[model samples]
Target: MTALPYRPCAGIMLIDRHGRAFVGQRMDSTLEAWQMPQGGIDPGEDPLAAATRELWEETGVASDMVEFIAAPDQEFFYDLPEDLIGKVWKGKWRGQRQRWFLFRFLGEDGDIDIATPHPEFRSWRWIDPAELPRLVVPFKRALYEAVLAAFRPYLNTQIGIEAVSQSDRPR
Candidate 1:
């Protein structure tokens, strides 16, 4: 496992107006693990495009329904547990190297429909950003923590005494 390359991937942390992040339970998993939208970055594909594509594939949230926020200047990585190293992803990769994006969901809940043509989630909901790590599988806790740390500033900020809206964000 140590010798295998990490799979390239993109992850999305969709934020609601209340500063919560979207998470979903994997359809095939028996564990109580819930995770943010993420999936492999196809060969030669831009990570941002992959994030947008994966968002629709997993949660039925289209790019137009969300506004791009921030992405870490660096990538995050996590390795599969020993038992999973040789069994997942055709044993080709040891883990994933992810470029995570934060996007503000612009539409109402009705705009999201997880029952896609190729659904990856069983159920989904918005969660407090601070609770992310505890909700995910143990192996991904660190990655989630790092993501929170990186995106914390933008989640909600006070420039003085006023709250900024999406319109105030730079183009």
Candidate 2:
């Protein structure tokens, strides 16, 4: 049998003011599954643009609410499990080859509206970047880890931490 090709995709890491990453509970999963925004890239679409579009479609976050931060030098890839190889995506693809982005969320929590025209998530929340791998499906754990690694430098910066006035700090 011929090997199946990978689907071109884009992934998003939406980081809020508190330095937490957005995670959504997939409407299609029965397990305690959660993941960041991701989707197949449209034909002839730019990967970065596709990432912005996916972020909005899946999370209801508008472009104004996000600022693009950075992406890894290399895209990440993952394979579907044997049982799912021929069931998902019409079996046209074996897995996804994803280009990921780190976007800083500039809007308030109320800005998020998951009831998109085609909602992929049932619910969502912000999570620590370190916990992303544990939150996703086992098959995609490595992918999540790589994403975290790629964004590690940004995660450590003061980008997501809430600031306090000097008076508010413990003296």
Candidate 3:
């Protein structure tokens, strides 16, 4: 069989004032499937704009409350496990090719309301970037790792703190 094409998508790494990344637990998941806010890029939409829109859709954090940090030099791609190949995204996609952006959250915690017009996550929290790759579902781990690496330099820039290694969790 021919390989399915990857869906074009954008991902957000929303960081709070403390430099912790935002992760959400999927409502459809039975396991601890936490992930950064992400979604498909609409036709003719810019990836960074899609990232901002996805953040609002998934976290209720508006574009005004966030500032762009940086994007990876290249998009990262991930394939779903064989069991999921023909079951997800209406089987139109093998997985996703994502353009990731880091955004610094400027609003207070009260500004976030995950109960958007359409909700995807059941619960959400701020986590250390190093914990991100471990918390995400297994198939998406490498993607998260690449995101972490790409966004590591800017994690402390907004907070004006010492830089943290992408692979090292804070003590």
Candidate 4:
């Protein structure tokens, strides 16, 4: 029996000041839903570093404009179709164990440029946090919910401030 191969990865759930989270629409494909920016960790690369790199690569947001808001978390045990196992990438049966980070975007929204040399997302948007569970892939819905719940305090703080500020502004 062949041993199952596993890969370790990392990702970021970028939240903006308006209490919205970033969701990237996959390009050049038929998928209907969007997802967070994520990628595989290079050998010897730290999970945080990988998450930062992926955020920049996929969303055009630099690490300098974002702050690390939490520690690592894991989502494991995803099974790929048998035919796609070796064909997509050289791996056996095991799935990715990912560490996710939550980042607060400090840069202007216009700074996002997915049209870089190697684009991952064709388009991106800031969506409400409550909508994330329905937008992400079904297999990843639970993980997304967990991440959102873990980061809810930070999100709520920002949201409250925004509401107060908006109400205080002149009409």
lDDT values, one for every candidate:
0.87, 0.86, 0.84, 0.72
Q: Model 1, 93-152: lDDT tens per residue? A: 999999988888888988888899988889999888889999999999999999999888
TM per prediction: 0.91, 0.91, 0.90, 0.80
Q: Report the backbone clash tally of model 1.
A: 0
Which regions of candidate 4 are displaced past 4 Å? 1-3, 73-77, 81-84, 91-93, 157-171
How well is each residue in 22-139 modelled by candidate 3, as lDDT tens digits?
Answer: 8999988899899999999999998878888899999999999987667766889999988988888888998899998777789998998989889999999988888998999999
Cα lDDT tens digits for candidate 4, 1-171: 136765677868887877688898888547777888888889999888888898888878888998666553445334444555665446543555677777778889998888877897878899887788899767667777777776675576345212222232211
Worst 10 residues of 1 by lDDT: 157-166
True-structure RMSD, every candidate = 3.5, 7.2, 5.8, 7.4
Q: Is candidate 1 or candidate 3 better by lDDT?
A: 1
For candidate 4, the per-residue lDDT at 72 reads 38
Error of 2 at 40 (Å): 0.6
